[model samples]
Target: YFVGIIILPTVREMEGREGESEGGTSTATTIRRLEIEITEKRRVIKREQAQLQLLEQELEKARLQASKEAVIASQCVDEWGKPTQWDDTAHEVLKGVFKKKTFRLHQLEAIRAHLSGEDVFLVMPTGGGKSLCFQLPAVMPGHALTVVISPLLALMQDQVYQLDLVNVLAATLSSADDEYEKRRVFDHLRSMSNKGKQAPSPFLLYLTPEMVVKSKELLAALEAVYKAGNLSCIAIDEAHCVSTWGHEFRPDYRTVGQRVRSLFSSTPVICLTATATFDVIRDVASSMGLGQHRQGGGKKMATFRSAFDRPNLFFDVRYKPQSNKDQLNALLQTVQDCTEKFGSSCSGIIYCLSVKDVEGVAVHLREHDVQAVEYHAKMEVGARKRNFELWMKGHVRVVVATIAFGMGINKEDVRFVIHTTPARSISNYYQEAR
Candidate 1:
């Protein structure tokens, strides 16, 4: 009886424990099932979040595209798919921007051609109003921006300042600028590139061709503008640099025209060079995808050759003397005679063969009671620009410099140019002389 009793209780306890264990197993199984359900729900939420983000991006893009179209709608097009003659609003803008009431015949020609979306080659002399032709087109109703390529930083800055004075938005890129200025300009370009959300500002962005070809961000930005159809025109100032063997050849320049053409197939190009020969002109046109092309009923070239002859410029070549002192004396005599003919406070550039020669000439002149400054590539840019301005203001009577001194300079009262040696090419000579 005792054994039966002990065995029975043990068996009953075992049965009871087994029952409790089964209950605990059932609860754990339900917990695992709940955990799996929660995980699947989390995955679904994540996918929904990603999809929501994508939709937001698409919505933003559509909004941006709508704004761009609205701004473009403000512009009217002609039968040729070119911008029409701007309405009274354009006339008002032009009146405020230019100081003059009427355009020159060549200016009018360029303006009409530009509005017609025709590729053009403008060969106007230095100090002529060639800049105005390109500048006026940038102010038209449809153009979002104009990318002006120039080799000289000084020239870019001077042009930007002049543009600003006349109520056009202009900015230039240079390593010389501080961070704040660069950031501000980049922001402006970015917004300008974003399409119709903002009416395109009357902005002109100037950069070296190197910046366009080499800077990834800037190139992306420019490409974006063209892709958006905001590129009015590309005004290649000093466009002869596009040729490999041209004057002021920058290797970077030779590639920019082609790159721009490759990027913007439909965008028109206008190249202005004061001194390109027939061969150089051909090269530039080819690089820009513009040349003697067939339009309408007959074949015609887009090149517009302004007369190169300047009546005010008189040239005289004198052979160098054997003795160094005699050479210096002769040059001094020429300068003295020029001052006697013109006023004593006349402006001139004395071209030296090298930097050392420039320094020597300036020092010699200084020692002999001549007031002059030395300018060369070796000097700091700020100092060089200061000296150039001093000369422009007539504060200095002479500037002894290498060939580095005078491209895109706006001075017109220059009365004499004395060279230590003949330029390597006649084209170069005419350019320096004119």
Candidate 2:
């Protein structure tokens, strides 16, 4: 009886303990579910926060774009409240001698718009008459001045020379020119701006970015001219330098947009580049604050492409052993053959990979009884000027240069361009070739 009594109490106690354990397990399961729900809620909040930040950024971008569009729209209107058209005389002059190409329509339209005080970006090919877009406007009445910012002094000089041929009063400011000469040029410009002048001054002024950035006097003079309402437009030649990816990176080019804005807010800016990829175009437009103007209805800028194909020329690539003397002789022989067949009037360019090569090749050509000249960055200004003048006047038949010969050069009759080595990139090749 005693054993039965002890066993029965123990069994009852074990049953009660099992019931308490089950209750505790159920409470722990409820706590785990609550913790899981809290974690999910935190994740959802974080996702929403990220989305909000993205939306904010997008909204800011949209606002900036809208403001730019509004400004452009306001400025594009004519005095009579209509989309402007080119002047009949201007149109006739442009279309008469100028051959009609793919961009002719766009060019005419751009000229008209620019004359009416609207900024434009003409992204045309190298030989696509980009200069005419601004050149024609520069000649128009009431358009007081067109300041062209070129990357190189040689280019500025070449442009000025070409403009002079057409009886356009054009002046260029470069480091090559002396201080006295610069002062004289500045004085002449001031005289032209005088309301009582008999013969008006040059409509176009070409300057390098370095001249503008480094000289406080030039900047002041430009500001004064702008205040007098003589500055009508600012043209950036070879504008791709604004992009870091461009073969030439000019820090001065980056300051051009701000300079335009500060000095001549009413004056329109025209950016011209020969070769630019889509990404490069976007980068340039962004760096120059042209992103909004380039975009249309929230879309990317439209690129104007002419035939990049040069059908008249043949393309060939050759890999030869490293024999400098043999290569030079062979190149000269080929040039002679081409000249003999194509006649003495056929002009060509010979590119060297380095200044040393340029000098060496030029000397060899001279020794071999060829009228050749060397052009590189290291040459003194007087030497470069003399060399360029000799080449322009047909005194020299060939120029051996270090890839700096042909930029903004107006020599249209160049029949051939020989490369000692392959160009650094296709853009460079096309630039030199064109």
Candidate 3:
């Protein structure tokens, strides 16, 4: 169908110059109008499809909750623990739950800090099992509610889905969730609240910072959890945003830091990010009230740092000094090399600096028969999510994206990550590429 549409230009449109057409109305202009109409219609279809998928997801979630509640009622689930020391049992539990036989050095360190009840500033490289750092501690036998403030809805969903698979009882509050979904999650929290030492399940509630600040109802619910003495830890993923460069994306992040402290004064808070400078490190600690600046000034802070090294990745700097055309050709050559190294089926993400650049690169790549999709902040949220899923599923080979494209994306086999324009900083580049 798309091929037919591409090849169906009117005779006058092909024969005439830029503006000339039959009846003094340019056929080219008519074609462009039709193309735009088709694009708008496609967007409508995608939106409807996304809504349908959301309904399906909500229904499936409800079913899962029903099944889980039944099991909880039928059996005695071990409530979470509060370990004073990192023990062999905890290690064995992690290995059993996650199907891993060993703990990475960084994982053990992060777990040790959590066991000690230290406010942590964890900076591990991307794909470095950082989620485990927070998640493992959540299952510790304790009356600790771990609230994870993630940066994006997609990220929250991904993390929750992973925990859900392990039967660890994670839930999220987000705009993407319908009322039914939200209510189910709230019910779980309410059941856990004021139960003294008995939590129905080990709960990890994920929220976007925007939701944290704007939702009065959510804030009230969090207060209930805290009042129940179940509020154990607050973790901020993509922790870079709270301090230095991330305020533009969500300024309310700072507000979240303040609110969490006010709500749970003694709760251990951890901020985990893969990107930050030496200076940004201290700033993050200060901004989140860690180290000597912790609320009461007596808490110890574990600033766990993992080396940001990828031995498998080879980094290079290429210069295209001639012209825009030359630079584009250089990019094509690199993409061609990747296509050869990996099969045509391999996927990649191409980073662009601006929305217009994303469009331009996507058009050019598509023209050259590279299955490319465009994603930027300017698009509707549903559209952006759809495009991301396309690339993730290999329906599209490349996503020409602006800076906000790849946060918390779990695709591990992205064969290439190309930065057509250098990001504002090296930190940003490492995050996208990683």
Best by TM-score: 2
Count of clashes in candidate 3: 7
Better of 1 and 2 by lDDT: 1
Task: State in Å the error of residue 299, model 2.
Answer: 14
How many residue pairs clash in all the candidates, one count each?
2, 0, 7
Reference-based lDDT, residue 174, model 3: 79
| lDDT (CA) per prediction | 0.74, 0.72, 0.75
Q: Which residue ranges in model 1 land beyond 4 Å of their true spot?
A: 1-95, 164-167, 176-181, 245-249, 291-301, 323-326, 367-371
* TM-score (C-alpha) between model 2 and the true structure: 0.73
In model 3, how large is the Cα lDDT of residue 204? 89
Clashing pairs in 1: 67-196, 68-196
Candidate 2 lDDT by residue in tens digits, 1-434: 45554435588898899889998998999999999999999999999999999999999987887566445433432322344555665655554524332335256556666665555666666677788888877876566778999887667777777777767778888787888878887996676555544545437888888887788888877887777667777888887877777776778877765566556655667777777655566677666555243224232222333335656777666555468778888888878877897788766788988999899989998898888998888998779878987887778888889866666577766666888888777778888877
* Pairs of residues at least 3 apart in sequence or in different chains that clash in candidate 3: 80-141, 80-142, 81-140, 81-141, 81-142, 82-141, 145-232
Using lDDT as the measure, which candidate wins?
A: 3
Worst 10-residue lDDT window for candidate 2 reads: 294-303
- Better candidate number, 1 or 2, judged by TM-score: 2
| lDDT over C-alpha atoms for residue 265 of model 1 | 62
